[model samples]
Target: MSDKRVPSMTPPNKAYPREELEEMMQKWLAANVEAEKAGDWPTYLGPMYTEDAVYSWNIGPNEDFVAEGRSEICDIALGFQMHGFEEWEYPYHDIIIDEKRGTVIGFWKQLAPYRRKDGSRFEIAGIGGSWFEYAGNYQWHWQRDFFDFGNAKDCFFQLAGAGALEPVVKKKIHQQAKGALLPGHRKLREEPSRWEKARNAMAMVKIAMTGR
Candidate 1:
């Protein structure tokens, strides 16, 4: 991994009003719908982030991804990370917005572009969600995603076993298995885990219940 540091999650210098945030989030969602329809995530979704925005997600216990700045977020995160998933469907099921905090959470599912032998869609077995920190002007300053890594792995294995995995995706999987670090990825200990917030919340709940 490069010695380059991840950007800090500093609060914006100014707070956006609740009304403005609500409107901005709605506009963002509408634009996202168009982007998904067009199948051009980098072109449509990249511009909707602040110049210095950060986007991150956890792959598993040993690795995590972090793309700092809009350029990396677009080229690497949105572009390269989606190489084999171009035709896949990731429809959002629900969205929750916190106007006061200027944040939004979107729940979605990962479905293969093609159906299985049984005539059913091949879907990952767990729900995926993203937490976005709104930056005024219908843009996001930060984003962190949550999902079941194990379920994703299992789904890919199932696809491979069924001879449904794409050639490019198989290559990607082999490359990743070789231990070469992909761009924007770091060892878990080097970069903060994306699950930190969730784990903290769980800890809080446990403490509250047990008075520990």
Candidate 2:
């Protein structure tokens, strides 16, 4: 749990007028509500990204998921990754839009489809959210998701041990263990982690400004 590895950081994106960003976000949010209700992510969310969008999220300490371009984003990130989660609901708790930076953050909950034997809803522990960089035309060019890997593991184990997991999900867990890496997943060292670059930039800026 003490691994020092950090996920890559997205570069600064082009900014838009605050009014434009707000209007776009409002429309996008309304569409998202309907999409969530329908549970058709690939169909609904795929078009929300630019053709050359990049989407990424950390799987754990040793692996990361990165999908480049909209096709990959839709097929791998949205399609394969979401295969067994058709019935799950991710209700947004809050949304923050940084119009100056052309970014949007949405905090949500990952709720399972089924209830526990004790009649309580099964949900992943810890917070879940997505950070997105907006493109000018109502599309996102970059996206990253954050969630607690440990909590996700514990929840999955509890459901699986109790035989409450969806059949597809159980199969997927086995496949992930034994099968070859999916299209977008890579070993942690495979890609150059962007945190180092960000750190170097910060140091250079500080040195220039303060003569340190």
Residue pairs with backbone atoms closer than 3 Å in model 2 (clashes): none
Off by over 4 Å in 2: 1-8, 190-212
The whole-model lDDT of each prediction reads 0.81, 0.81
Across residues 45-153, which tens digit of lDDT does each residue of candidate 2 receive? 8888999888888888778788888999889988888877878888888888888789889898999987888999889889899998988888888889989999999
lDDT by residue for model 1 (1-212), tens: 66554566554545568787778767767776776777778888898899999999988876778998899999999988887777787778888867766777889898897677789888887879898888777789999988889899898888898888888888888888897788788875654466987898899999999998
Quote each prediction's TM-score: 0.81, 0.80
Q: Residue 63, candidate 2: how far off, in angstroms?
A: 0.7
Task: Assess candidate 2 and give its lDDT.
Answer: 0.81
| Top TM-score hit | 1
After superposition on all C-alphas, the RMSD of every candidate to the true structure, in Å, is 7.5, 10.1
